[model samples]
Structures are given as structure tokens and as C-alpha cells.
Target: MNTVDALVQLSFQVQRILAEAGAEHDLSIVQLRLLGILRDRQPGMLELGQHLGLDKSSITGLVSRAEKRGLVERSPSPHDGRGVLVALTPAGRRLVEVGEAQINRRITELTKRLNATQRKQFTQLASVLVNT
Candidate 1:
């Protein structure tokens, strides 16, 4: 297969894994992404929306739903009183940990045919592609 086809097929496989993991956790892919994004740092709604490629209203609704589910919290931004920052609650963090484990397990299984060297090479190449 050509590179484009190979990448597309691989993306589909990854998306399937993500869908399965999200379903297991009762999360949509976007919600899973939100949790993943929150695992490290707190960001204001605008930044989150930009990262997620969501518009303001859509992002607001997404955050509201997550907030209602006790998975995330919103607080006044330290830099701007009018701005709100979103963060993962303890429960959200736990969910992310579990979801990540599930994804890792499944992806590792899928890539089991590759030897250690191939896996390392793939990782390096993918990282370069992603970072660019």
C-alpha cells in the first residue's frame, strides 16, 4: 500500500480502538480527547476549543456535559477573572488512566507482529510526522 493508504488504514484501526475504549468508559471520542488533553495541564475554554477544533458553543456544551458528569471542573482562570479554565477531577484522571491502559493494550496487540526494532522505528517515524 502507498503511504497515504497505509496511514489512513492505521488511523482507522486507532479510531476503532479509541471507540472501543470510549464505549467501555461511557465516553464519546471527543470526550475521551478532552480528558486526555486535561491529563497534564489546565487550559482555558478558548485554548481547549482551539486544540479540539471546536467552536465556542460546541465546546461549552461539551464542557458542561463533562462537568455535569463529575469528570471535569471549571474554575476562574488565574490570569483572567472572566475566563474559565477546565481541569480533570480525580475521577476524570482515573478514567484517563484506565482508558489509556486499554488503548495501549489493544494497540500493542495489534502491532504484535512487529519486532522490537520495527516498533522503535515506527515510533520514531510517527513521532516525527506528528511533531511536524
Candidate 2:
């Protein structure tokens, strides 16, 4: 297979793993992404929307649903009174941790076809692509 084709197939395989892991916790891929983003930084709605590639209304709806599920909360931004930041709740953090473990396990399984050296090289190459 060509490099593009191989990369596309690998993307699908990884996405499938992520979907399966997120499904175990009743999260859609987008929701999982939201929680994952919140696991580190608390961003205002505008920034969050940009990160998620969502518009204002769409982001609002997503946040609302997560809030209802006790997974995320909105707080007044310390820097901007008019702006609200979305953050992961304790429940959200716990869910992200569990879901991450499952995803890691599944992804490790997928990489088992590679030898240890190949796996290390692949990780380095993939990181370059991601970071670039």
C-alpha cells in the first residue's frame, strides 16, 4: 500500500479503537475528545469551540449535554467575566482515566504486530507527524 493509503487505514483502525473504548463509557468520539481536552486545560467557549471545530451553538449544546451528565461544568473565567470556561468535573476525570486505560490497551494490541524496535520507531515518527 502507498503511504497515504496505509496512513488512512491506520487512522480508521485507531478511530475504531477509540470509538469502542469511548462506547464502554457511553461517550461519543466528540464527547471523548472534549473530555480529553479538558483533562489538561480549561478554555473559554470560543477557544474550546475552535479546538473542537464547532460553532458557538454547537459547542453550547455539547457542553450542556455533558453538564447534564455530570461530566463537565462551566465556570466564569477568571480572566474574562463575560466568558465561561468548560472544565472536567471529578466524574469526568474518572471517566477519562478509565477510558484512556481501555484505549491504551486496545492500541497496544493493535501495535503488537510490530517488534519492540519497530514500535519505538513508529512512535517517534507518529509523534513527529502529530507535533508538526
Candidate 3:
């Protein structure tokens, strides 16, 4: 496959592996990503959209859907009242923590599948990619 197609395939595999498994809770990958981003900062919608590579309207819609689930909230930014800040509610934090652990576990499991030489290559590549 071409590089773009390979990247797309990798993304699909990652989303499928980490996505919520039960009918009781359904969150899209974008929603999950937004939660992760919020875990770091209470970003304004504009900043959040930039982080998520989405438009403001799209981020707003995603936030609206997540808010309905009691997972996230919007408050006035401490630095700017006119600017709304998006943050994870306690439930959202729990969800993100769970997702993080799950992702880490899966990655570890996958990494262990590699032999020693391949494992070194993987780690080296990951460090460079992530640092970049």
C-alpha cells in the first residue's frame, strides 16, 4: 500500500482496538481524541479544533454530543471570560484514563510480539516519530 493508505489502515486498527466495546457506551474516535486533548488542557474551542485537526463547528458539535453524555463541559476560560474552555468532567477523565491504559496495554502487547531486533527498530522509530 501507499504510505497514505498504510497510515489510514494503521489508524483504523488503532481505533478498532481501543474503541468502547459495550453497547452501553459508544464514543467515536474523534470524541476519544477530544477527551485526550482535554485531559492536557482546558482549551478554547478554536484551540481544540486545531489540536484535533477539525473545524470549529465540528468540534462544537462533538463537544455538544459529549456533553449530553455527561462526559465533558464548557466553562469560561480563566484567562478570558469571552472564551469558552472545554474540559473533561470526572466521568470524562475516568473514560480517558481507561482509554489511555487500554491503549498502552495493547501497544505493549503488540510490541512484545516483535523479536529483539525488530523491537529495537520499533522503539527507535517510535521515539523519533513521537519526538518530531
* Each prediction's whole-model lDDT (CA): 0.96, 0.93, 0.81
Cα deviation of 127 in candidate 3 (Å)?
3.7
TM per candidate comes to 0.97, 0.95, 0.78
Off by over 4 Å in 3: 1-9, 20-24, 115-121
| Candidate 3 minimal-lDDT segment of 10 residues | 16-25
* TM-score result, candidate 3: 0.78
Per-residue lDDT of candidate 3, residues 9-94 (tens digit):
87787666667422124776777788888888888988989988998789889999999999999998889868999889999888
Clash count, one per candidate: 0, 0, 0
Per-residue lDDT over 1-132 for candidate 1, one digit per residue giving the tens place of the 0 to 100 score? 999999999999999999999999789999999999999999999999999999999999999999999999999998998999999999889889999999999999999999999999999999999999
lDDT of 3: 0.81
Ranking 1 against 3 by TM-score, winner: 1
Clashes of 1: 0
Best by the TM-score measure: 1
